[model samples]
Structures are given as structure tokens and as C-alpha cells.
Target: MYKARAWLSRSFTALSSNPLRVCVVGSGPAGFYTAEKTLKAHQEAQVDIIDRLPTPFGLVRSGVAPDHPETKIVINQFSRVVQHERCSFFGNVTLGSSVSLSELRQLYHVVVLAYGAESDRALGIPGEDLIGVHSAREFVWWYNGHPDGKNLSPDLKSTDTAVILGQGNVALDVARILLRPTEELATTDIASYAWTALEGSSIRKVYLVGRRGPVQAACTAKELREILGIKNLYVHIREDDLIKSPTDEEEMKNSRIQRRVYELLSKAAASASSQPMLGQRELHFVFFRKPDSFLESNERSGHVSGVHFEKTALKGGGPGKQYAVGTGEFEDLDCGMVLKSIGYKSVPVNGLPFDNHKGIVPNIRGRVLKNISGDSSQVENGLYVCGWLKRGPTGIIATNLYCAEETVASISEDLEQGVLASSSGLPKPGREGLLQLLDNRNVRPVPFSAWEKIDSEEKRLGSLRNKPKEKLTTYEDLLKVAT
Candidate 1:
């Protein structure tokens, strides 16, 4: 294998050339996937993947549910992608700050913005501005040890009941984390600090809330079912909680895993209502609670204490059917902590046009918008976007493969047309347009070779501990350790 990789590297270097420089911002699944596609599709092309986290594997390192170690195995595959002869990595990078899209366009013939979303959707409710309110995004980062989330520590020490808003996979993730035993978390890459805090949780009940009915919920069937399978926890479901819906063939036929999930949920639910004697923990699958306001204890606490929800009724199609958020009734649930898993959001990088509301680069298809012509401007030529950054944040891992391919096809088309940033090749005698743009913006993107050393050191350390490589969470740590 070593000999084979060495041979491939030599061949790749021999084939690589100018005019095929590609830079990808963000080292998440999407970013690395895009770089891998570009390098493999065009062996002569040079690919550089960058990220603000001194580490790579964006969400895998910072946001994937820590209990899902198998899911994180995807990182090993990405490691090989980053090892491409034509590829490199630059951690501790801020696109708008350290490297601007404008400057990247100057150096690389094609600059693909594959950075995934950077923020979370705001649950605009009354007490949301208070001391107890938080987003699952922040919670995930804190537990995962993202540098930006290093200081985030929620007081789960005394919590008896917790509320998580939104029913997506992320909402389910937080619920599981709050309920899992410490022994289960031992093998995962969960930060030591997070483990200690979580180990001490007094949490007895967690309500995973959703605005829409169960059938209409955004969470995938797999994610929802897995959470219900926890052995000791009671899963409560009110008959009224699950809006009636006609069953699909898949749901009726009961695939093997789906059958197991149903059995477990039934068992948990029966145990919850029958015994009501849950000694240490409880989990509920709740629906039809549209959060109208967040209850707070302090002004600057920025933490949520509880949630005020508006009563919503199905339009007779069942809970999963389209339902309306109305003023027919209202209810307040009591809890000391609340997490808004409403959804993930994108952040506007510096220079490239952005839609503050959508958290996506303003684009048509995969193209960046030069300007908003009217309803929406056409995507700009040469500048392409893919994955979460291209589309507003959503979709699982496989979803990005097709997404990245779409962008790659666009890049290939642009290259054939000679419509890229003109004269972005080697530095010329007098005037360098792209370099001048980088100078004007003060953006400095990293190269691919640098990423190799960072990858090596991280894995070397990871092997020692039996966890995925322990990430260099701080920017300085990455710069100091990475070649």
C-alpha cells in the first residue's frame, strides 16, 4: 500500500500543471469531498482545502453526535482524499479574514466555496434573549471541543427536565447525549470536559419537541428510531402526540431495523405510562408544539428556562400531514433548560455576496451572484458553490456527493470556456490582477502539502489514545504543530 501510494504520488506530481489550481474552503465532509473530486477528475489540478478549526473533518470532529463512532469512520476515507498528491490543507483559516474569495480567485483558476454552514437558525421567541436559551449548534461544538465553542458550558449539573426544540436529527442527537450513560461515551471522541459535565447530569427527562406532527417531522426514520432503542430509558408517546397518517408500504412492511425500533418504542412507551416508575430517566417524542416564546431567568444569561408553545392541529390529514401554526390555543411547559435545534444556518463570508436571511451565498444553481438583478440574480461564472453553502443547510452525507459533482461539472464547463479569473496563473512581470485582489483584501489561503503533515500528526496522536485523532482545537496549536 505504501509503495502504491508513493507511485501514485509521483505520477500525480508528473501530471499536475498550472491553470488547474483549485482551492476549497472548509475541511468538512463537503469541502474534502469536493477537493477529492476536483483532484481525481483532473489529476493535473492542485487542490487545497482550508478551515478555521485547526483541525479537518469539519462536523465529524466538531458536530457529529459523539455516540455515533461508526458514522465518524467516514473520516478515514476523507484522510485518503486529503492525501492526494495534488491536495493540501490549511487549518486556522478564516475565508473572509485570512483568505478572501476574491484573493482565492486570483491564485487559483477555480475557487470553490464548499464551506458548510457556520451558524444556527435563531428561535426568535420572547425569553430566547435570556440566560438559559441555547442552540444545539453551540452545545454540539462545546461537547466536541470546537475552538469557537471552547467556553460554552451549560449548567446541566442540576437539570431534571430538558427541552430541545426542533425534531431533526440534531434534536434527537442532543436528547440522546443528555440521556446516555458515561460508559457508552468512553470510546468516542467526546471532549474530556464534556464527558465530565455530561457524566454529572441530573437530567431525568428530555422532551424532544417538534412544531409539526410526527409524520411531518424533518428527522430521518433511522435517527428517530435509534434514539427510541435506548434500553433503560422510557419513551413516552401520547396517542394524541402522533398525528394519524396513512401508512406507507415501507412503514407497514416493517424492514428489519424498523421492526426492532417499533418494538423498542412500544416497550419504552408502555413502561413510561404503566410503571411511571422510571427511576433515573425518561425520554418523550412530542409533536404539535410550535414554540412561540422562550422562558428565561436572566437577561444576559442567554440561556433558556422553558418554552411557550402555540397549539397546532392537523388539517385532518394526520400529524405528519401539513399543519398550520395558529392561535387556537397555547400552553407553557416547565423546564430549567432549553436548546433550539430548530435547524443549521450558513454564515456569509467576506466579499462574496450573501443572503443574511438564507445563510447561503446568493446564487442561482451553483454560480455565485454578481448582483441581485431582480427576484434573484443568475449564479456568477467561474465562482461555484456546493454542499451546505450552495444550498441552505440541509441533507445527509450522501446528499453532498451529487451536490459536489454538480459543482464540479460547472467548474469543468467554466474552464473549457476560458471564462475563469483571467491570467491567474504564475506571477507575471508588471500587473497581477488576482494577487492585487488578494493584497486589497488581505486574504491568505493555505496550500495542500501543508495539510498532509497536519493529518499525519493528528492520526499519530489518535492511534496512541484509540480515539479518532485528538484534534488541535486551538488555531495556535494547529499552526504550531502543522508543517
Candidate 2:
């Protein structure tokens, strides 16, 4: 009943006239941005944004660190997009499960796949499967209250040291959570269960290990600055490690952001060396150390004891072209917990042509291809891709704005060039048909108003705890609250 009136706001029987029906799979930044752009570009277009979970704002709700609330302000803009008369939001409707990609194409004129990376790149080393090892993605999801990671139950109680492999913003976020005072985190919207676990954690030192030098650090300066400023956290940056090589110096000269980050690292190292605050909670920045393997603990069977790392140095290739090559020297750093933050990779939907090697859908300028050859002639009719699914997992949240623009532009260009001309020249049933298909399957989709109920309930509970909003970390709780 809601879907019938979703697009045909004035009439219940049929659409106005030849409306361009668009279905966006994924309610994250990319999906929402695609919907917004579509609606703006085509006045006669109707857009539906859907996700697998019962709530919208995919990564903004589940991926962003709780401490970095500022980064999630984009949700307000997206809220306005779904509030548009020609747009709607549907949750609890999965593309590959509840409805197939073929089903979506038949119901709508165009279908855009924007579902983001659901898995991380594997470390592919021995002992990585040890009990204490986890991907930084899982750890972030666990702490952020993502339902999939609600029961991660990392072993924070067993050891005083935690080793994080990678130097990205995510690595710093994980490091900050492990080292930041729980009292400060309590004021944020961190999951109550996670807060309880971290409040009792024995982890006092976290190693933010990177394969390359500081100049090539993947983390932005803003993230790096925040980690260095955490109160009572003594940051360890080796003075000798800060000495940039020729390639590193060239990189810094070309990039202002890199220069600023290295300067921050240098300042932190100088301050720590001069002040020498020993025995305090520490956050170590270990560069030029590439993890070779995880060492099994003799004390605790099937658990990790430490990480075996090979020393690495930069191989010159001019500015950003440099890469790390391992040297003969090796070292071991003991730690009870390990989180590898290498990167995230997108999982392919059932009917999509995904390039397994690149971990993205095979697309050219946002047009989905029939295969991985990437030829313009192979563009799949009425199918498109955007965000991390179109490109590899990289860039910040704002990056999606530009990426979505390219996809939407392609859609517009196709419409104008008659590339999407209907063979029958007839309007699609769109949401009206989709609702019937879903009803037959007995799959109920949560609407935007229903999501508002969950949002309100979360905020109410959070107010009780003096937090921003306490997340419901289980599907049962979220669905119940929505109901």
C-alpha cells in the first residue's frame, strides 16, 4: 500500500506519464547521492533507495567511527534527498536475496548498484587465522554497533598490547579507540556493550604499524592529528624513523597534506623524546615494518602471541610512484590482539559482472559492462554502477559526491542520446510492480517513517545515557523499535 502511493503521490492507479523509474541498491552515501542526482537531473524521474538492513545510511551509520561524528553530518543532506516528493527509502529489502537484479531491471527503467565493500582484503599470511587476529573492518563494525559485528568479542581483556597493521585513517581510528580514555568515549555514541568491554580492557599500548615510511602513510592529516592529540596518550614516533629518504622528500614536496602529516609526526617524536613520559599509555607509530606472519602463542594455544615483521625500504619511482621492498632484517613485536587494516573490497551481487582481481564491478564511466574487458561496446543496457562498487575501495565520504556525479551524468547522457530508448515505448510499473513481487515473497520493507521511529528510540535511549544516540546492535531490537 505504501509503495503504490510512494511515487504516484496524487493517484493510486498509475504513474503520471512515462516517468523514468530508477532503483538504487544501497542506501549509503553513494546510493543516496545517486538518487539525489537522478531526481535533480530528470524532473520526471522517480527514485527508490533500498538497503539490506532495516535502517538507511549504510556506512555512515555502521562504518564511521563514533568519535568522528563530524564526518557523519552528511546524513542530514541525504535525509533531505529521500524526503523529496519523487524519492523514497526502503529498508530490509536485499537485492540478491529478497529481490534479484533481474527483477529490479524488469520493475524499473534503470538500476544502479552502489552497495559498498562488505569484506576486507585478506592478509594471506600464516597464523593470520589465529584466535586473536581480526580485520580492522570487523573491529570498526563491532565498536560502531553494526549488527554483523555485534558479537565480535575481541580479546581486549587478555593483553596490554594491540598491533594494528596498516597506516590508514581506519588504523588510527582503531588505535584511538584502544588507547583513548573510555570516559571520553562514554560521552559519544559508541555501542553500550562495546563501551562496557573497552572500559574493562587491559590494552594499554597500541602499535599502528605501516609497511612504508610516514610520507606514504595512507591516513589523512586530520586523522593523524586527532590521534596525536588524545589526552594522556604518549605517542611514540622513532626519531630515526622520521628521517625521510630521497623519494619520501620528493613526495612531501609535491603534496601539502603529506608534508603536514610528516611535520605532525616529527613534532610528536621531538616532544616525546624531550619530555620522555615513560610508563604512560602509549600509541606507537612503527613505519617500514611489513608483517610477514602472525606468531602462535605457546602460552595460549590457537591464539596469536606476536607479529613477525620484515624491515622494508622505499624503492624510488618518483613522488607517489614509490613502493616498499623488504630487507633481510626481521623483528618481532609481541601483542595479544592484531587488527589488519590493509583495505576493504566489494562483494559482487549475484547478477553483476565483478572483476575479482580489482574487487569492483566492471564499468566504464559508470556504465556496467557485460564482462571485465572494459570495452565501451559491452555496456549493459539500463544497468550502471557507482561508489566503491564502481571503483575500488578508496577515498573519503566526500569522494562519493564526485563519483556519483559521473554515474548520473552517464545516465543523463544515455537518456539524451537515445541509448536507453524503450523498444516497446511503454512506461514501467516501477514500485507498483516491485511491491507485488515482494508481497508474493512475503518480504516486508521498512519505510522512511518506520526508520524515524527507530532513530527516535535510539536517541531517547542515548539521552538516558547522556550520549548522542545509543545504537540498537541487533536486528530484533531495531525491527521491534521500528514496529
**lDDT, candidate 2, 315-351, per-residue tens:** 8668999888999899999999999999998998787
Give a tens-digit lDDT track for model 1, residues 1-483: 343233223322212234366778788878877887677656577677767766678887788887787888898788888776667776666777665677667666667888788788886667776665789999999888787886787888655889888878898898888888877886677776788888888788999887655555666667876787676876778766543445422443444544444444445555565444638588877777788888764543555667788877655342223565765698888887888897788887667788777777776556778754423445565677888988878888877776776677666555555566432345211113443554566544344455566667766776786766665555566666654
Question: CA lDDT of each candidate?
Answer: 0.70, 0.88
Q: Which residue ranges in model 1 land beyond 4 Å of their true spot?
A: 1-17, 243-273, 298-304, 315-321, 372-379, 421-472
TM-scores for all candidates? 0.83, 0.95
Candidate 1's TM-score reads 0.83
**In angstroms, how far off is 205's CA in candidate 1?**
0.9
Residue 92's lDDT in candidate 2: 92
